[model samples]
Every structure is written in C-alpha cells, then in structure tokens.
Target: MEKLQVLDITGLSFTSLPLSIELLENLKSLCLDQCRLEDVTIIGKLKGLQFLSFLDSTIARLPKEIGGLTELRFLDLTGCTELKVIEPGMLGNLVNLEELYMENSFDQWEAEDKVPRSNASLAELKNMKNLSTLSIAIPHSVNLLRDLPFGKLNMHKIQIGEVWDCLCMHKESRTLELKLDSSYLLLEEWVQKCLQRAQDLHLGGLQDGNDSIHDLCIEDAEAEDGDEIDDDPKVKSCKLRRLTLRNLPMITSFYKRADYPVDLFDAQQLVFLVTSIIMNSVGYSPFAVNEATSLEAITIERCQLIRKVFDLEGLTTNEEVEILSRLRELTLSDLSSLEYIWNKNPQRASCFQNLRTLKVQNCENLRFLFSSSMAKALKQIKEIEIVSCDKMEEIINVQEEELEEAKSADTLNFPILTFLSLEELPNLRTFSYEKYDIHYPSLTRLTISSCPKMMTFSSSERKQQLMRADIGLQQAFGHINSGLSLPVFFNEKVLFPRLEELKLSSMCRLKRIWHNQLPEESFCKLTSFTVELCENLSHVFPSNSMDRLQSLNKIEVVGCPSLEALFEWVCLSSEKRQTPLVLSALKKIKLWNLPRLRDVLKSDRKVNFKSPCLMEVDVRCCHSLPYLFSSATARSLRKLAILEVSVAITYGA
Candidate 1:
C-alpha cells in the first residue's frame, strides 16, 4: 500500500477513507468521486499528491488538514452538493495549486454564520497566485470582494456567481464569466469596469431596469467631465472580444432606447455575441446593432417578442448601412414569435453577403426564411438548415411582385450552396411559390421529410412550363388521377444538378418521382436515393430515364404500400427493348414492408445489370412479389454476395 502511486476509490460506499491510506506517501493522484465520503483527513497525509477529486460525493465539510497537501496542483469538488464550509487558511497553503473547481458544491453558505466563514475561506484563494483557473460562488458581502486578491492574481479563466461582487478583478485577467440568478441586479458601474478589462465576458440573468447600458454610459460620461484628468491609463474602448448574454429576461434591445448614441456598437471590439432566453422588450428590436462591423457570429435562441431580428425602421440613416458584414454564422432557434430573420429590405440584403452558415429551428411563427431579394445577395452561404418549424411554408419566399419580375428574368441561382436540409415542416407546399428556373450547381446533399402537403418539388410556374412541354400522360393503374396533383421531382428543370444523395420520407401525396422527361445530363452525379412511408408513391423512377442514372449505386424503398413497381417503362416497342437498360454502377437495393409491390420493373423489357460491384438485395415483408427480377434479370442475382429475402411469399418462384 505504501508503494501505491495512484488511489481510485470512486463509486464506493465508504463513508471515510481508511487510515491505512496515509501509508501511501508516494501517492500522487487520489479520486473519491461518487462516493459516500464525509471525511478526508487521511488524504492530507499524502504529501506527494498532486491531483485530488471528490466529484458528486456527500462530503459535508473538507478537513482543515487539506492545507498540508503542499504538492497539490489540481483540486476538483464539483457537484459536491452537501459541502458548505471550508476552514480559514485551508487554501492559503496550496501555493502550487494551478486549478480549482467547486461549482454547485456549497449549498449551506446562504445561512448567516456560514456566509462569513465561507467568504474568509474563499479569500484564502488569493495566497495561491499560481491559480490559472478558478470556479466558485462569490458571497454577497462587499468586504469579501475587497479582501480577495482578484486585482493581484493572474487568473486566465474564472467563473463567479455575480459580476458586482467581483468588481475588483485584475485588469490583466484575460477571461471572466458570471452565472447570476434571476434575482441578482446588474450595476452599470460594475459592468463598465469589468468590460474595460475582460477580453472575453459572459453574463447571464441580467434583469431589466432603467439602468441600461446606454444609461450607464451617460452617467459615466457625466462623471468623467466633473473629474480632473489623471495620468492613469485605462481601456478607451470596449476591449471584449466575445460577449455572451443568456437568460436575461429584462433586456429587450441591445440599447435601452433608439435615441441613444450608436457608440455602443462603434466603440466595442466584439467578434461574437450570443444570447439565449433574452426577451425582446415591447418596442425594441432584439438585434439593434447598426454599426457592429467586427461581429463574426450572432446566435439568438428563445427570445420572445422578436418579430424580426434587424429593425431597419429604428435606424436613422437609410444610406446602405453596412451591419454584420464580417459575420460568418447566424443561428436562431425556439423563438415562437419570430416572423423574419431580417426585415424585408432590399438595401440591407448586402449585410449577409459574408455569412457562410445559417440555421433556424423551431421558429413556428416564421412563414419564410428569407425574401427573394435577400436570397439573391446570400452568395457566400454554403449551408442552410431549417427544422421543426410548423408554420414555415417556403425557404425563399417570393412576393407576387417579385414572382412577376422573376418570370421575366433568366434564372434564380444559389451559386455556392452545398448542403440543404428541410425537416418536419408539415405545411410546406414548395421551395418557392413561383420559380424561375432555380439552379443549385454546388448542392451535393438534399433531405426532405414529414412535409405531407408538399406534392411537388417545383414551383407553380415551373410546373406550368412542364405541362406546356407536351409530355403525354395516359392515366393507367391504381387510382388513376386520384393521386397528388404535383410531381415529386421537377418537370423540365434540372434541380440539384450536382446532388450526390437524396432522401424523401412521409410525403403522403407523392405519386411519381419525376413528372416529365429529364435531360440526359440530369441526375448524372446522383449516387444514392431513398424513399420511405410515402404510401401514395406508385413508382421509383420514370420509364426511359434509367439509362441516364449511371452514377446511382443504392436504392431503398420502405413502407410504401402503393408502390407497384420500381420503374415504369414507357410504351417502348420490342425493337427499342433490344437496347437493354444498363445500371452500370448499381450495387444495393432494399424493399421493405411494401405489400402491393409486384415486380422490380413493370415491363418485360430486359434490364442489363452490368455492375460488377453489385452485392446486395434485401427484401422483407413484401408478400405480393413473385420474384424481385424477371427470369432473365434473376440470372444476375446469382453473383450477389448477400441476397436476403424473409417473409416474401414467392420471391424465388
């Protein structure tokens, strides 16, 4: 036991460390996490211990003897809920301590006697000047802040309870984070003092009052005029690089009032500002930053009363205001009342030119992501994701006037867009209401699911173009014209030209994958296609287009009960049938829970399975299929490495 260099008694039921533990003089690390440890006097005897952890334990008090561990460098007491008091001078002896974590550890400190004693114990932390990281709850007493060596210590990272309590922080400290409760009040003097020094500042639970940031600045300026000029150096501008405000229910706007000076955004060097659960006040916009050019990212979540993120009406100047030009990422989530990301302004569209990624989720009131005019200016956007928005009808909403103008134009293009995912939007009708030859040349992946009302993937104008192209459609099987009125794929236009993967699910009204004949160059790069729970879908691909899908390797169809066949071969004469449909790259096919499926192909025309890499065929619960392939096509399945057929009534017959 004396030779043991590491001791781990974690998750044990022991209430106290064994006295024999003191014999391990060479022990350098000790872990008692998730144990019933109420006493740790034996730990102090391990003079060589450098690391000590008591996470999630029931220990009520730390032994005063803990100061004797002079070699201790890392101490973690996180989640020790019962721990309330620490003896004075306990931490003063840990001169070599580099990191200390005590988050949610002391719950009884709110009582009278425990508060002062705990403050004194915390004051001892100043003696350990080597502490680079510290996380602790600051007491409400003013003397505790004055007595603590915050201005002298060189802590690079610190997390405290209240900002006002730690007003005396070291100006040289690089980072400070405050996690205040809802009841805590934010003083302007303390906030301005901290912002002048902290490089990265995070504030939470800042209650609203007349003492807003603008009011604070006004008071500070008045005081500066009354005082004599001194030689003491101070940060002239807001030096904070990152500012995060969370759970601030009282703050409605970035500024208290619209008439306030714009210097709040101009003077700050902030690169990122993230706010969550911060309600927008009745008459103010959530993002009122008009001159924040240095901001690179802005994320707002669960902010109420935010009808639109940017309020252009509040701006004094109409002259092409360049706001958030350097921003690379923007995210908005769970804002129930959010109607638009940015107010529909043609001039302000240029602000999003540098944005690379945009994500919006659970914004139920948002009818559209962006207007058509704004979409045109988002040339740098590489990825767009929208999910669980119940009211979202379109991604790029085109007004009636814009639709008329688009019809006269050549094309609507998303030049650099590579990834698009739309999910759980039940009322979505189309990507656009009136499409004018929409093109996505760089798009590689596409996903659409749970959009039951989405019958067609094309715009109303594009559908009319297909209907005008004279594509003959003689109603044949099942319900004839009773299916959805729109086609699953676009008619004459080639959407997602570079698309590599496609997923479609729960689209109850889908009838055909494509309405009209696609150009030979269409879907040339598509490698995978999946369709599931689309009960109204009858066929996977149109008749003669299989020859164009040379890159298709995998196909999956599951729970599509009305699907009668995989391909609908048009009235191809016997002479044309001689030119076999060859899928050169096809490797895998999965058909599951499709009760009405009869054959893989509806016609007797031969399909030449020329893919040497073809390996799998999985068919289960498809009771009506006599065979997956026709007699001639079945010969090709003999070379497959995996041919799984279960509960399929007559698969081999």
Candidate 2:
C-alpha cells in the first residue's frame, strides 16, 4: 500500500473506507466517486495525497483533520446533496489547493440546526491563494461575501448560486455562471459594475415578477471618485462570447426598445446562445435586428409562450438585413405554444445563408416548418428533421396567393440537402402545399414513418428532382406521370432516385409502393429496402421494376397483413416477356407475418433469377404460398444457401 501512487474505487458499493487506506503514504491520486461512503476522516492521514474526489457520494461533512493535507491540489465533492457544513479551519490548511468543486454538493444550509455554529465560513477559500477554479453555492447572507478574497484571487472560472454583492467584481474571472434561488434586484447593477471581460455568462432561475428582461437594466452609478461610470455598463460588449438563460419564468419579453438604452443582444462578439424553460419570452426576433450577426448557434427549448422565432419588423438598416447569415445550427424542442418560426412577413430580409442543420421536435402547435419564402432562402441547409409535431400539415406552408404565383415561377432548389427525416407527424399531407417545382441535388437519405395522412410529396404537379449521380432521378422519374392525382403520386414518389437505403413503417394507408409502370433503371442503385407494419400495402414493386434493381442486396417485409405479392408483373408485350426479368445482385429476402401473401411473384411472364451471389431465402408465418419461386427462376439461383419456409414448396432445382 505504501508504494501505491493512484487508487480508483469509483462506483463501488462499499459504505466506508478501510483504515488501512492510511498506510498508502505514497498515494498521490484517489477517487471514491459515486461510492456509498459517508465518512472519510481517514482520508486526512494520507499526507502525500495531491488529488481526491468523492463526487456523487453521501458524505455530509468534512472533518477538521482534513486541513492537515497541505499537499492537496484538487478536491471534488460535486453532487454531494447531503453535505451541509465544513468544520472550522478545514480549508485554511490546504494552502496548495488549485481547484475545488462543490456544485449542488450541499442543500438546506438555511434549515435550523442543519449546520453547526462553529462551521467554517467559505471565507476559508481566501487563504488558498493558488485556487484558480471554484464551483460552490453561497448562502443568502451578505456576510459570507464580505471577507471572501474576491479581488485578490485570480479565478479563471466561477459557478456560484445565491449571488449577493461584489462577487461579480472579480475582473480576472474568465467565466462566471450564476444560479439564483430567487430574484435579485441588483443583478443589472452587478453586471454594470463588474464582469467587464468575462467570456461566458450563464443566468438561471432568475424570476423578477412580471418584469421583462428589458426592465432588468439599471443606469450606471457614479463611482466613489465622483466620476460617472462609462456610458456602456455591460460586460465589455466584445468580450462575452456565450450566454445562457434558464428557468426565468417571469421574464415576459426578451427585448423592448422603450425599456432599455442598451440591450444584452448588442454584444457583437457573442457566438452561442441557449434558453431553456424561459416560459414567457414571446420570440427571439428582436435579436436579429440588434446583434445576431456573429452568432454561430442557438438553442431554444420548452419556452411555452414563444409563438414565433424571428421578427424583423423593427429592422430598418441594410446591415440588419444580413443578420443570422453566419448561424450554422439551430434546435427547437418541446415548445408547446410555438406556432411559427418566422411569421408571415413580406418585408423580412434576413437569411440563414450558412445554416447547415435544423431540428424541431414535439412542437405540436407548429402547423408547418417554415413559410415558402423562408424555404426558398435556405440555400446552405444540408439536414432537416421534424418529429412528433401532430399539427404539421406540410413542411413548407405556402399561402393560397403564393401557390398561384408559384405555378408560373421556376423550380426552387435545395442544392446541398443530403438528409431529410419526418416521423410521427399524423397530419402531414405533403412536403409542400404549393405545386412549386423543387429539387434536392445532393439528397442521399430519406426516412418517413407514422404519417397516415401524407398522400403525396407535393400537392402541385411540379417537377421533382433527386440528383444522386450514382443512380440519378432519370432512372426513377421516367415512369412518373406529371399529371397523376394526389395520394398515388405521393406513394409513387416515396423513393428518391439516388436513395441507396429506404425504410417505411406504420404507414397504414399506403397501398402501393409505386403506382405507375416501372422505368428501365428504377432503383438501380438501391442496396436495402425495408417495410414494416404497413397494413394496406398489397405489393412492393411493379412487375418489371425488379429487373433494374441490380444492386439490391436485401429486402425485408414484416407485419404487413394485406401484402399479397412481392411483385406483380404488368406484361407490356410478348417481346418484353421473352426476355425474363433478372435480379443479378440479389442476396437475401425475408418475409414475416404477411398472412395474405399468396406468391412471391404473381406474373405469368417468365422471370429470371441470374444472381450467382444469391444466398438465403426465409419465409415464415406466410400461410398461402404454394411455391416460393417459379421453376425457371429457382434453377438459376446458383449460390442459394438456406431456404427456410413455413410450408413445403416445390423447388425445381
């Protein structure tokens, strides 16, 4: 034990440490995090300990003997919820301590008799001149802040709760986060007086009744030298790069021109912003006209009253027209009252020119993703995902007037889009309500599930393009009738031209995979196709479609009770029948729980299976098939490995 330099007993179930740990005189690092230990007085006996952690443990108090560990440089007690006090002079002796973390480490510090009168003040931290990082909760009392060495210490990071006064005055702190238990009226005063060069600021649990964020600002007070504080009392506007606001329920509005002379959004250097559970803020559009030019990312979640995201009504300058041009990512989730991302605005000029990813989830009131004008401007968007939004009727909502105008306009293009996913949107009817032509030049992946009412990809008879070069749209769109009516075209266009993998599940109303005749090169580059729980689907592919699926490696169909045939041959002519359809790259086929399936292929025309790479055929719970494959086709499956079927079927070879 004397030779031990490091010992990690993390996540162990033991309740206490053995006294033998004291014999480890050479131990330099010890971790008992997430353990069941409650008392650790024996830890003090290791004079050579330099690092110690008891994170997420039940330890309640530190023994006075712990002060003897002068060599301790790092100590962590994060998530020690039962901790209430520290013995007097316990921290004063650890003069070499460099980092201390006590975040959420103690609760009920105000309860009667919860902490001993002799308990040491956090002022003991003042003696640890070398401490550079600290995360601890401060009591509500102002006395704790007076004796603390705020001006003398060079702290690089600070995460504190129950902020009183003067704590923000530490100019050397690079990051400061405040988690308030209650509203503090002097918040603006502290920000104006101190926090001049902080790079990151996080404010949580700030609730001043019925007052918006605009009202939080206070005029700069005159300094003791009789000189008025600088005109802009905010943290040096160019220094703060990231800001977060969480659980500020009473903040009715994020910004108001009449309430403040200067706004926090005016910080020109800000890059990342996050707001969660800040219920009453109406929208973030205010920032667009003010200071959103440098922002790279933003996240807003669970903010119930925010009905819109971007409002550009107040923008008047040409520079404001280019706001959010550099933003690359945006995420909105669990916002029940969010009705629109950008409300109808004929004058809106800002564009998401650099946005690459967008995600929206569980926003039930949002009837659509964005207006037609906004969709046309997302030139750089590469991925879009929408999930569980019940009221979404279409991804891009176009007005009746706009729909008329779109008929005479050229096609709108998503030049770089590669991935699109829509799941559980029960009311989704189309990708766009207007008949505007749209092209996805780079799209390679698409997923759609649980959307029973989705009848088509678009309501208008417009040209659609999926430009995957390996298997271009020319292969699939050749058979599509531009004049075909609503729901059928929806099912027909389900498969993109360049799609290599496809999955369709729980589409209750889906009747056909493709309604028109099969093109000569249809699904030529497809590798895998999967269909599950699609109750109304009767057949997967048209008769001649399988002939061009040269790259198809696997097909799986399950829980589709109404599926009757895998392929239904539409014999075009005797000339076409003379040359049997071939699947040269086919390898595996699995069909399960499809009771009505009568035949794998229901064609009188000859079908050829020339795949030397063909390996397995498994058919289970399908009661009506008399034979798995036709005689001529079975003879050509040279590489067949396993044929598992529910009923004995005649095999020609």
Candidate 3:
C-alpha cells in the first residue's frame, strides 16, 4: 500500500478516509470526487503526495497538518460548499504547488491580524512562484489586498462578492466577477490588470452609493479635462463582455462616455448588460454602442422599473445614431415599469434604419413606443407586436416638446412595414395623435384586439365620436354630404394600401369598421378579415364602398350581438340607386352567434359582381335571417361545399 502511485474514487459513500489507508506514502494522485469526509488530515503524512482532490465534498476545515505535504503540486477543493476555513500557513507550505482550486467553497479569508488565526490569510498566495492555474472565491473582500497580481496566472476564475449569477459559472477560461459594493481598495492596479485579462468578466454593482456608473465615467472624463481616454490603450475592456449592476436605484444610463476609472478594453464592444434594479434608461453609451457594429439583437425580460430604452436627449450627430442602427431585432417582455421603448427629442434625429422587427409584451406602464421622428427612421421596419400593455395609447407618439415641430413634417410613413399586431391594449386610442397623417403604404397584415378606445387609425383632420359618424367627421363634402366618418375604424388620412389580413376582437365601443368610400388604394388587397365579440358593429362593410373589396378571400365574424347585416346600404341625399356589395375573391365565409343579423346583404339593387370563387359558407344562430342569398347570387355559388348552421340556413341578400 505504501507504493501506490494513484487512487481515484468517485461518487463513493463514506464517512471518513480509512485511517489504515494512509499507508500509501508515495501516492502521486488521489481523487475522491463526491465523497464525504470528516477528517482529511490522516493523509497529511504522505509527504510525496503531488495531487489531491476532494471535489464536491462536505469537509468543513482543512487542517494545518496539511502543510506536511510540501511536495503537493495540485489541489482541488471545488464545490466544497461547506468548507469555510483553511488553517493559516497550510497553503503557503505548498511551495511546489502548481495549481489550486477553491471556487464555490472557502471564502472566509482572514486579515493578517484577525482573530481567526485558525483561518488562512490570502498573503500566503504571494509567494507561490510556481502557481499557474487558480480558481477562488473571496465572498468577503475586507480581508483581500487591492493588488493580488491575479493577472499573472495563466488561467483563473476569481469571484469576489456575497452573491453571484451561478448561471455564468464554468463557461469561460479567465473570468473576474464581483457583486460587492464599490470599494477602491479592491480595484487597485493589479485588479485592473486582472480585468484586462478576463474573457467573460462581469463587474457588478459598479456604482458608488447614489452615483451611477455613467456618473463615474463622466467624472473620470472631466478629470481628464474632456480628453479621450489615454492613447496607449492595449486592452481596456475588450475581453470583458458583460457588466452587471445590482441594487443600483439611481442609475439613469450605462456608459454614456468612453472614459472610465479602469482600463478594460482595447477592442471597444460590450455584448450584453444585466441589471437587477430599477434602470432608468438603455443605450445612452455612444462609444461602446458605436463600436459594436455587429450587435444584431437584444432581448430584455423579467426586469423591473425600466423607464425607457433609448434616451436621445442631447444627441444630434450621425455618430450617435450608430447605437441601434445595426440591430435588426429587439424584444422586451415582462418589464412591469417600462414606460417608453424610445424616448426621443424630435428635433434631434437618430437612425433605426436597419431595425426590422420589434416585440413587446406585459409592459403595463408603457404608454407609447416611438416618437414621430423615431418612426421616420424605421425605414426597414417589417414587423411589430405589442401585447397586454394596458396603458399603451399609441404606437407612434408625438412628444409634447416636438408637437409643433411635428406639424411641419405632417406625414409619418412606414415604407416597408408589413405586419403589425396590437392586442389587449384597452386604453389605446390611435397609432398617432390627432395631427400628423400616419401612412402605412405597404402594410399587409394588421391585428387589433381589446382596444375599445381606438377612434381611428390616425386622427389627422378626421376625429369622430362613436355616435357622431352620421354627422360627418368634418363639414359636409360635395352634394352627397355622406357623413365621411359614418364608419369610425379608419379615416382618409391613414392608408393601408396593400393590407391582406385584418383581425379584430373584443372592441366594445366600435360601431363601424370603415368610413365612407375610401380611395381605391386603401384596403385594396385585403384577403382575410376576422372579427369576434365586437358588440356594437352593425355591419361589415357599407354598401357604397363594397367595390373596393375586390381581393378579399375569407371572412369570419362571431359573437357580435348588435350586428345587423354583412352589408348595410345607407343612401346619401343625392343617391337614388344602391350599389351592390361584391366579395369577388372570397372563398370562405363563417358567421356565428350574431342574433340580430337580418340579412347578409341589404342592398336593393341587382348584384353586378359575381363571387365566382366562393368555396365554403358557414352560418349559425342568426335568428332574423330570411334566405341564404338572392336567387341571382345563389346561381354563382358553384364552388360552395361546407355549410353548417345552428338555425335555418336563411339570410336575405
């Protein structure tokens, strides 16, 4: 047994090491992974022991007798969660040790003069000339020196703080992280060098008292008399990709300037930042954001008290627009205190030209997402989704500071926007306020649900109350005087030229879907339309504008009790003839639970447009109907197949 060279035991249940097993005097490697041990001092007599590991063990203390193993080359105590103390002078006695690991374990390092004379001091590490690899946790930094020379090690992961993000463990070769309060004594020159050497580093709680990290950088920048950080930069913050701030309640933004207290990167880019407190803003940093050209996407979720994402207050230069220009997608969710996605100054323009998609949900305090100028910069925006934001009244808002200025630039155009969905926003009134004309020239699909307060898509020059649609949104036009806002969903100023699908539901105050005859370009390509639980709608389309739906393919309406007909003909004072409603491209139609519906079509004129493509028809519970369709319209239903109804299949055309 004295001649044993190696002994490895993994996941073995044991109370203590066999005292007789100490006979292995020449053991060069001894690994007891996941083995519980009460006393390991019995093996201390093995002076030639070169490697020892008690990985994931429950050992409480490493005895001073461990010093007897002076020839030890490696020691691993990783995952020894209960190990709080190591006898003073024991680690220093390992003069030949080459590697040491104590991470997630012993962190109770005592100062040289502390009463825990039983506990080891970090000073012992100063003399280990052969030590190249190290992993340690010093949860309390009061006992550590500001200059530990950790940068000299080839590979190291040093965590110093009370709490750490465990999800970041074991993912990097060299890392330095801390959740401790800002202490200058712990961030001295050697620590700065260590930060420069880290690969996946995190500097948490970098704030000082009431001051934020941006304040720190601004102060440092001012100290240099507004000069850029020193020219002789090898690496200031390149390797450190992540920064975390915890419990910093007063911070307004992150890294608004390039200058900071420490030298961190040579390649100027920050990948992601995670904060655990009330953050007032995001993307206020110009230097870091401008250098991160490859940053494509950002997702922030489960955060608390974030007021805005971008605060473009004093920024006017094209250089500042580099912040979010390269980002193609941005998603924010579960942020209860989020107020604005982009807080902008309309006079100063920044670019979001490459941002193609944006999604937000569960942000109850968010009232609006973009300012007018911000929307103008979204030239390539293709998709937007907002859900469950109770206070959101507008997707593009005209800030009070820029209201008068916005009037000069009257139109806000989304040139390539294709898909937009606004769901469960009960307080929403309009996409833009009552002034500027918002135009979606390329909009293809639109979905709005539970937005009972939406008076119109845009209220520019056309504002109407729910019951005032018959009195015209504006003064009477021409000889017809056909109240322009009779239907209140859309106005003339806002256009959906290529809209293919529109889904709406649960809109309690909606009495109409569209106003009087819109231009030929509005809703001209609509293919599918769906509505559910809208109690006040009397009809789907007004008879005068029915010819504009030449490309509609499918229609589904359900649970609207006050709905009277699919098409309702309202004659203007000069109109003596009714125009027939034609869904020429419609292939499928489903209607359900509309109790007051008397007819699918109410026009008295003979039908001129034939729906040669009608494939399926479904109707149910419409108690006041007479016949399915007029005899002339039924003759063209050659492709009709699936027909299901709760009441008789009867509807007057």
Best by lDDT: 3
Ten consecutive residues with minimal summed lDDT in candidate 3?
216-225
Question: Which residue runs does candidate 3 get wrong by more than 4 Å?
Answer: 1-294, 316-321, 345-349, 407-409, 461-487, 570-582, 606-609, 648-653
RMSD of 1: 8.3
Positional deviation of 358 in candidate 1, in angstroms?
2.8
Better of 1 and 3 by lDDT: 3
Give the lDDT ranking, best first.
Answer: 3, 1, 2
Candidate 1 regions with alpha-carbon error over 4 angstroms: 1-85, 92-179, 188-251, 261-297, 313-322, 345-349, 400-407, 460-488, 515-522, 573-575, 604-612, 647-653
lDDT of 2 by residue, 227-325 (tens): 223333431122343444455544435544433332223221111322211111233334332442444555555555566566433434323345456
Clashing residue pairs for model 2: 285-311, 435-460, 456-490
Q: Each model's TM-score?
A: 0.70, 0.69, 0.60
Clashing pairs in 3: 236-264, 236-265, 236-266, 237-264, 237-265, 238-265, 627-651, 628-651
Which sequence of candidate numbers ranks them by TM-score, best first?
1, 2, 3
Residue 214, model 2, lDDT: 40
Tell me, what's the RMSD of every candidate?
Answer: 8.3, 9.1, 9.7
Candidate 1: the clashing residue pairs are 252-281
Q: How many times do residue backbones clash in model 2?
A: 3
Compared with the true structure, all predictions reach lDDT values of 0.64, 0.63, 0.68
| Model 1 worst lDDT window (10 residues) | 274-283
Better of 2 and 3 by TM-score: 2
